[model samples]
Target chain A: MSIKTSILSSIGQKLLLATSGLIMFLLFLIPHMGGNVLFLFGPDMFNSYAHHLHQLVPIVIGIELLMLTSISVHMIMAFRVVLANRKAADKRHTLKSSKERSLAARLMPVSGIMIFIFIVKHLLDFKFYEKAKTTLHGVETYDVYAMVLSRFQGDPVHLVFYVLFMVAVGFHLSHALQSSIQTYGIYVPREGSKIKLISAVVGWGMAATFAIIPIFAFIK
Target chain B: MSKQINLTLKVWRQNRGEEGKFETYEAKNIDTDASFLEMLDVVNDELTLKGIEPIAFEHDCREGICGCCGSTVNGKTHGSHERTTLCQLHMRHFEDGQNVVIEPFRATAFPVIKDLIVDRSGLDEIIAEGGYVSVKTGNAPEASTTPIKKEMAEAAMDAAECIGCGACVAACPNGSAMLFTSAKVSQYALLPQGHPERAQRVKNMVAKMDELGFGNCSNEYECAVSCPKGIDVKNIARLNREFIKANLGKN
Candidate 1:
């Protein structure tokens, strides 16, 4: 009984990870964009919203932990599947052949890893560092929202990195969503066509939403 | 209106095994109403008249049903149109002065046997590796007894239409046989007759597909795109799920 469910669970696990990953990405992005809209009220309002999150420290910490775990599991499973495919393909030919799959599917693992690295840097810059240490402006616990925006605006380095990271995220979601649907057994022509369309729209939406924040931050 | 169209053909020529090169020929004014394969017939007839060996290619039903006339024409499989096969491809798609590049199917498993003809037995090898309904025919109950849903039946039929041509493998950059083998597996797996060997079938077929020097399905779907019979990539997806379930010891 235990083995049976676990076996079934492995198949579900990948779909679950992908579904939850996509949800969390969209959830965080939508609200994050909404919060950025507060920038229209000036940097102070944005800074104050960041302070409110700090005040709700317990809830913030809890959500952070959950997000971290979800992300880790998703990344691990995705990487495992990618590695398995690589090994499976390699064992067959022995001689390396050029990519025979679509460009999107072929580069999924590399793109995913890049997005993962970007996420880590993102957390360190805005979330952890600001929470752990004082800012150079002599403010304790940091003015994270402002600090982030200022980095994008004044630092060309940060702006370029953010844009590149968003592009990677877009491509990752585009391929992952389409392939994940296929992975889960929804491959009929009609459904497959719908999935492809939805994946493209969602992927572009994610990249655009993320890009909006950086663009606004740069200008303001 | 069937306008007369003059076209130059650049076709891959090979006398025998493994070695082949492209040879160019000027096809005189031909009726644009002819099917792409019919146009090829004209060239072959002219070659025979001149005592030159006619180009060798494979085709069975010219109705796009046999899946035998698989080739890359002008860089697209089965000609430029989507969901169209070579026999179904008409000369109307080409311009008068256009140069058509005709080549044999290319893949590690599909070795070229002659000019524009490849040995696609790799597909059969994968299929035989376990792409079947193992249930004994006489011992089985009535077909209506199982009562499968109409949708599933239709989907199974769609997959079953795959004629084991290696066009999907040729179109795919990775030479993945996932579409071909998976469609075969899914066609049977989707049906009631497929129940007995469900687990073993997917496992054996997938393993065989990989062992035959085919690439893993990355879901680029070029296989579905170039399939002359329009075998959907969904079959490949179903195959993936079936394999994962089998590997994990689930039915």
Candidate 2:
């Protein structure tokens, strides 16, 4: 079979999705979290961080390309698998029970879609928006901290949307964390519950920390 | 005398290649000690006595070992109790004057053959693909010669408990057979005898399962819950791991 068809097959699609998701979580998520945390350190720290990131244009572009590719692969594979799963089962159960399935597991696709939208909107607001810049020490750099505060401080709707998206990210990661491990075949039966708990904590923790940044920006 | 309960059964009836509907039947005075299949037999006997066609369901062993008997009772596969097959579920679990709805295991892959009977040969086709060890007969070592760890043995045995029953597919919302296929893969993957052809075995079997119209697993653990053998869903994870490992270097 051709490599493309092989990867499109059931098991292959899942492997690609899980691997890409884990990679994005490691490379993109960690750096994004670090940058957002700089918001709490006040304007100079956050703006200087943005200025430093701007200086490494080539490296930033490389990482951005990789992130785009990873996100595309992950989303495409997920959609194919979900659609195939729906087509495979032609009937629905009249009486259903959720004793085994978690809410996060069931809502993965929904949360994924939300996260996708949030990512695009976030990029538009912070990365591509042509806002006025402030010159610091005779160097013109984008005032990212001011832009963030302006977006949240006076706009309740924007703040709510951001917080809601963060919640969606939390739900998505709760399942994805443990699921990625399973895809890699690292399951220890005795530690199943422990793994699930850890996944939940990490997922919610990342989401909460990110959400707190905007809320803090608005209130401060 | 055993306590007897009368039940109202709404059993699905359909002929080969025909549309089916529910036909209500009254099963009166069934012994609480009777197996679920036996209770169905009692209903069929009454229908026969009334000069009416009896219900058609599949069953060979009254004992639960044979995977022949399966029916969705009250929206639960093999009945409401967990880990109990249709043949082993006792009538005592039901109250008098209760209503039970029975239907065939519904899936695109598992078509209705008759009342409460479905064609599960698709599962057999998956097993036929690569679900066996092909070691030479004379080269087989004595059982004691193979020193398997206790934990691994127990895990293998747990996976081996899968009776090839299609309950996993029936119970799943997506009708995925990943649990059943994964259990088979795990059973052999854990044993040394199955090491030689591990790569081909998982690859061929998974391809066949997908080809046979089984859905992809979306991490819903319903299959494990509905399994009569209580086969763990972790096997599915292991199957994924094996699939990735098998195809690591190849294009």
Candidate 3:
């Protein structure tokens, strides 16, 4: 099979999905979570961190393009693989039960769709939202800290929504992290796997870090 | 004397190309020592005397090696015993008043022919694809000539132990045959004799598997858990690597 034909194959499509997902996990989500942690240190640190990120315009644009491509491929392959799987399993038994499929694995597509919606809402709430200039460290910059505080401060609904979607993130990452390894042809033992531990830790840990922003902003 | 139990069986019943439904029957005087199939035999005998149609299911080797018999009992493929086939499951496992729900191994690829007997010709087709070696290495050579490593041989044998049963498909939520195909792929891929056709074999078999309306694996591990032979998903990981190597023009 050539590259094109293999890309069209079922396993090949899965390989593509795993690759794109890992790229986003490594490049995008990790850095985003890292930046989010600065929110805990106070307004200047957090706002400055956000402001300096705009200095790397070319690099950010390149990363954005890469992310755009990755997300598109991920969604497309997910659509095809899921639809094909459904078609193959059309005549399901009424009494079927799965003992080995984890809730995280079972809820992948659900969390995926939820996470997609969350990303759109998140970008609109922060990325695409207007950022007014403020004097910080004797330099004019976007007051992203104030923006976040104003959005979630005393707004229980928005705060809860942000925190709730993190669980969806947790669900997706917990499964995708280990699943990508298996798809790449690495054997993760069914029991006592360190990879499983790391997956859960990183998945929920990142979610917790992201969730803390809205929580602190809501309370403070 | 072994204990006898009376039970109710809700069995799926259907003819070829007909809509199916579950029919409940009382199985009285089931001996605990009897294998699940023998219990079914007793039920069939009773039904025959009563002029009712005997519930149709498949069985050849009552000991579980032939891969000729399988059915989902209460939603678990081959009942709830770990690594035990339906034929190997005994009546003693059931409670005295248990309600057993029996059904065919369901999959779009393995369509039910009648009652619990599904047409597993799809598996046969997958085997025919590349499950054999054709190097023309004439009459059986001495076993000592091959020089197979101990661990490698054991792993190959492990992969070779799969009986082509469709339990993996039935257990998979997506009706995937990945476990079955991976076992075949791993057995050959691990041995020296099968190296000559390695690249093409994985390619052909996977294509056939996908072409036959089997679902893609979702990394759920259900197929691994449901296999009566205790076939691990390690073979599946190897298969994914083998498929990549074969399809990536690495040959």
Candidate with top TM-score is 3
lDDT of 3 at B11: 90
Deviation from native of the Cα of residue A103 in model 2, angstroms: 0.5
lDDT of 1 by residue, B12-39 (tens): 8876554578888877777889998888
Q: Where does model 1 sit among the CAPRI classes? A: incorrect
Q: Model 1, residue B143: displacement in angstroms?
A: 6.0
User: Who is ahead in TM-score, 1 or 2?
Assistant: 2
Q: After the best TM-score superposition of candidate 3, give how far the Cα of residue A54 lies from its true spot, in angstroms.
A: 0.9
The better-scoring model by TM-score among 1 and 3 is 3
The lDDT ranking, best first, is 3, 2, 1
Structure candidate 3, residue pairs in collision: none
Per-residue alpha-carbon lDDT of candidate 2 for residues B52-133, written as tens digits (9 for 90 to 100): 8999999997778788998888988899888999999999999999999998888888988887789999999999988999
Q: For candidate 1, lDDT tens digit of each residue in A25-63?
A: 655655666776676576567667766667988987777
Show model 3 residue runs off by greater than 4 Å: A94-98
Q: What TM-score fits each model?
A: 0.74, 0.94, 0.97
Ranking by DockQ: 3, 2, 1
Docking class of 3: medium
